[model samples]
Target: MDFYLTALLQGLCLSGIALGIYISMKIFNIPDITTDGSYTLGGAVTGMLLSNHLPIGIVLPVVIIAGGLAGVFTGLIHTKLKINPLLSGILVMTGLYSINLSIMGRSNIPLLNYTTLFDSFHFIADLNWNSLIVLLFIGTLLILLIGYILKSDYGITMRATGNSEKMVSALGVNIDRIKIVGLGFANALTAVSGFLMTQFQGFTDINMGIGIVIVGLGSVIIADTFINWMNISSIWISLILVCLGAILFQLVLAFTLSIGIDPTLLKLITALFVLSIVSLPRLNLTRN
Candidate 1:
């Protein structure tokens, strides 16, 4: 029970990134590999601040801006230089490695002795349950914000820009600017995940974000799967499912580990699991 609950909390910590992926890949039609770099940037910033005894409130905005700038550069490069979306993301992600290290002044920062975002809550007697409550509160707030944005006129324009860039541009929307904001917002959310996870896990590691995008992709894929299967069209419900999908992804990993799989094979398991999720939807089409 504790094992699964831990997974649930892990999933909750990752909900931000999952939603970020949904925005970038599902809405913007861009596979933003900037996720890998921005994620660590978030953690790096959090670690650097907390190590200096900075408050969480102060740290969060800095993390968001740092992450946003990383994304802005990717979008700027992609649009102004006509670089391939993937290539632009790769360039930014590559650059963030050095930037993150420079910010932290080391490859890792341990925060076990420092105050963290999770320390403020005492609503529940059980440790894990308290964390769950905090995560739920934060997750709900994020979902509401993202959902509100997606339902707005600007969001519709953003969606249109992705669905048909030329058509949106013909209608007078600045698609380039839209892409930049979309990616910036998405990566900011990704950075928030890093912020949550570093506090949740009690340390920051330089390579922590490596391939972390796959986790978000898996969650988004699950949400997309259910959205299609249920014929759902509501953005609010879709956002909720994205958070649920993050939890489910972690639960699946927890189950896999509980079954006595070699711990060293976890990354391989993650890749195979995500590949299967990506492939299963297409497999459903074969039956038609």
Candidate 2:
């Protein structure tokens, strides 16, 4: 039971990143790989600030802004320099590796003795339960916030930019500006995930964000599958499904572990699962 509960919390932790990826891939139609670096940058910033006794309030905004800046950098490269979007993300992500290292001043930072966002909550007696409650609240709030934004006027423009960039441009909208803001917002959410995970795991590792993009992509794919099947058109419902998809993804991993799979094969399993999710939907369409 505890194992499963942990997986639930883990899902909540990853929810922010999943939303970030969804915003980029689904809304903007941009494969913003900057999530890889921005996630770790969030952890690095959080860990460094907490270890230095910084206020939690200050720490969070700083981490979010840092993540946003990284996205802005990638957006600039792609839009201003005319670099391919994928290559621009790669360049920024690669640079963030070194930046994260410098921020941490080490390869890892332990937070066993420090207070975290989980410490402020007491809705449950068990540590894990309390953590779960806090995570659930935060996750719900984030999903609502994103959902609201996506249903707004600016969000219409952002979504339109992805769906018909040429048309939006023809309307005298600054496509480049929209892309920058959208990407920046996406990465900021990714960074929030990193911040939460680092605190939950009790340590921050320089390489923790490695391949995190894949996890986010998998969650998005899973969410997309369910959303399509339900034929849900409400933005709020879509956002909720995205978070549920993250939870479902984690639950699958937990079940896999319960079955005694070799830990070394976890990455392979993740890759295979994501591949299946990506392919199965198209296969179903073909059969229809």
Candidate 3:
């Protein structure tokens, strides 16, 4: 039960990345693999600040800006250089490895002895429950903010840009700017996940974000599946479902571990699990 509870907590923390991926993939129709690097960048920033005894309030904005800039870098490469979006993300992600390392000044930064945003949250007596409470509180605020933005006039244009770039461009909108801003928004949210996870887990490793994009991809896929099944059109509902999908994905892995799956095979399992989610929708289409 405790193991499952931990998984739930982690899933909640990870929902930020899912939300980020939701924006980049579902909204922009771009597979911004920069998520891998931006995530660790967030962790690196948080770890460096926290370990230096800096306050979370100061650390939070810096993390967001760092992540957003990384995304913007990817956007610039893709839009200006006319490179493939996927390749652009790959290049930015590769470059961010060194940037993240330089920021942290080391391969790993431990924060167990330092105070954290999570540690400051203590609504209940039970430590786990408190963490859960704070996570939900923050998550709710994030969802509301993101939902409002997506429904805004500018956000509508952003979505339209994704649906049909030519249509958006025909409206005299700067399609390139929209794409860049959208990617910036996406990766900033990804950094928020790194912020939460580093504090919760008590350490940050340079390699912590390797293959992490799949987690967001898997969660967004689950959310996409649910939206299609339920015919959900509301942005608010979709964001909530994305968060739930993130939790569900983690729960599935937790169950796998509970059933005695080798931890060494976890990455393989993650890949297979995401593959199943991706394939299931197509399989349903074929069956129909």
RMSD of 2: 0.8
Q: Highest lDDT: which candidate?
A: 1
lDDT of model number 1 = 0.94
Residues 1-288, candidate 3: write the lDDT tens digits: 888888999999899999999999999999999999999999999999999999989999999999999999999999999999999999999999999999999899989899999787778898788899999998998999999999999999989999999988988999999999999999999999999999989999999999999999999999999899899999999999999999999999999999999999999999999999889989999999
Residue-wise lDDT of candidate 2 within 95-165, one digit each (tens)?
99999999999999999999888876678788998998899899989988898888899998998899999
Model 3 RMSD, rounded to 1 decimal: 0.8
In model 2, pairs of residues that clash are: none
Error of 1 at 266 (Å): 0.9
Ranking by lDDT: 1, 3, 2
lDDT of all predictions, in order shown? 0.94, 0.93, 0.94
Candidate 2 global lDDT: 0.93
Local error of candidate 1 at 145, Å? Answer: 0.4
